[model samples]
Target: MKEVTPTDSEEHVRRRVSEKCSVDESPRFSRQQSFGRDIGHAAAETYLVTRLSFNLLGYLGLGYQWITRLLALACYAMLLMPGFLQVAYLYFFSPQVKRSIVYGDQPRNRLDLYLPPTSDGLKPVVIFVTGGAWIIGYKAWGSLLGLQLAERDIIVACLDYRNFPQGTISDMVGDVSHGISFVCKNISAFGGDPNRIYLMGQSAGAHISSCALIEQAIKESRGESISWSVSQIKAYFGLSGGYNLFKLVEHFHNRGLYRSIFLSIMEGKGSLEKFSPGVRLKDPRVKKAASLLHHIVLFHGSADYSIPPEASKTFADALRAVEVKTDIIIYEGKSHTDLFLQDPLRGGKDELFDHIVSMIHAEDSDALTKDAVAPERKRLVPEFLLKLAGKVSPF
Candidate 1:
């Protein structure tokens, strides 16, 4: 009924076209038209499709991320199950264990001592140190080890030292020294024998313990006061440790996770030589103390990709070359973590565990008979007999 002018007709057509479009389609059409005007229709269509695909991918990526995280958590949970069970048994089941005994002023300088159920007398001691690449270690990591040794009637001293980013390698090693001193001075009350102490460490812990021993040896040679005697260490057990820092740096230079940590631990260039056990073992000071090295035992997993078995082999060879009594134990088809998980209670057994029990048994036997001396100590018998003969009147 209204008059149809050209301008009125044009306005009516525009309003009708807008009403026909859906809400989302209207904005997309406007954008496409603007883009088409600037960069042809074909190119604008391609851009719109690409944008749509990107938005869809973003939504899908979020779900994929969560799925990956769940898978990783599942894997970790399975790996930690064995250690968790051991720790649970130690805390809830074992009642004789003394825990959180402070050794130094720092909070991290505490240790746990696991005493055998039968407190008949002083027991052979094993001081264990757990590894965390010198960066991440907790005293709880040694709970399984302490329980294992305690079951064999050996006193177990599990130590916790300051970790990196909180303390430097020097501080970490110092904590170990302080802990050893404390153990030597006070372990008798806990049923631990000061004379029959064995030093055992795994991975980064091995490096720290070895360094502490080497340092102690150096101190004794220089007539410095050492809280504990090098001879008191009946044997040194190093498991999956990298003795040569120089080589370790070279080996892991490009590794994304370890490279930065190694660089931080070493401090700067040329500092690796200072902390390297293999390098220091060859030093004149350490060589002088080699005679007091006693028995050294090294364990390595052949299938370990994190740290090759060659590291242990090279270190054992070095010790042998220096005339130190050394033994190497190899675990075939075992990964780095497999060494700890191979618990008899976990439905598996490790050869190194048996070797440790033997060491403790042998040490205990020596203590029961004062006349018995280790085969390595046979050379000192002549002097011991001479002193005995002088003390006796008429035999």
Candidate 2:
């Protein structure tokens, strides 16, 4: 072969990076000008269309509130049975769906707990935040997650945080923070180990859960009941979750549904600096506190359709950048919700406690007791981490 030239070496490097990104090529000087123009035009069209739709919706929201309410009520009345049927599937099809609690002021948006039978001692705990793209969701999402943890002898709680139409993402986080504090404080009463609670959520729930860890809710009453340790949180497991609202809005082009759904999440309070996880990293505390190394766990599906894999990938890279201890599980062929509900896990569905058992046993060697880590369950920690150290050393 002829001697490789400097130009050839540069071309090879560019190609390698392009392949890694799964794009034909990086936006480079070599790209034709027409390509940029075409992309700009497409983006402009999308923006204009979305802006018009949002403008129209603003009018409808302001001028037709009662009309819309009546229509919505009529629809709900017609679909009440279907709604109930959907709930039945959630209860029967999903093992994690457990009981609800009337803990919040509104009562409708209250907390719920799901705990497995455990001995008198304290066991690990996992707090679940459900996802409804920030608009609609319920406390039952955490039930399935809680039951799994219970089977592993680790307690689980599915919280009911304030939702949109009445709260922002910041407000939701505040609600969750209180919810977390409430649930943790009462774990002992519910037969749980308050010291070992982990904050977990999916999608929008994950976003607010992240906010809860980073930002303290507007000065809440702190008491002995609110005592918690980040170390004890162990980690955050975000399944196709953790969408940076700023980037998410950009990713979806500020469309009507996207805006209504997302803006409603934050009470129209989203700021670039406040909403994006990547941007938030610029803050000293976020950079210092963020990482699987500290007390966060990240889970994402490589082929997720609801949210891009890059959502987790972006946060994962950030965690790695800080040398924080974070673990990510990318279900190679799984989608967004698959990682949550019982689906084809390793090709077959399992009992309600499958994921919880895996997560707890994952660190069995580091656990106080193998039986306690998961008791009779299997390990959920990464295989490499498990094999790297033959013994358990959680610290």
Question: Compared with the true structure, what per-residue lDDT tens digits does model 1 show for residues 270-356?
Answer: 667777777777776677887778899999889776578888998888888889999999988666665764333343344677678
Best of the candidates, lDDT: 1
State each model's CA lDDT, in order: 0.68, 0.55
The CA lDDT at 212 in model 1 is: 89
TM-score of each: 0.71, 0.62
Q: Please estimate how well model 2 matches the true structure, expressed as its whole-model Cα lDDT.
A: 0.55
With candidate 2 superimposed using the best TM-score fit, by how many Å does residue 301's alpha carbon deviate from the native? 1.3
Model 2, 1-395: lDDT tens per residue?
01211123334422432332244445573244434644564476457446544654553365443345445435433433333344445443342333344334542345555555545566677788888656555676555455445655676777776555545666677677766665655556555666566778888788877777655311121212333434546666776775466667645433234545455545564364575665566556554445323545677777665578888888877766766666766777655544664241122344323554566556555443544444343223333432232222110
Q: After superposition, how far is residue 325 of candidate 1 from its true place, in Å?
A: 1.0
Query: Which model scores highest in TM-score?
Result: 1
TM-score of 1: 0.71
Clashing pairs for model 1 are: none
Model 2: residue 37 alpha-carbon error in angstroms: 63
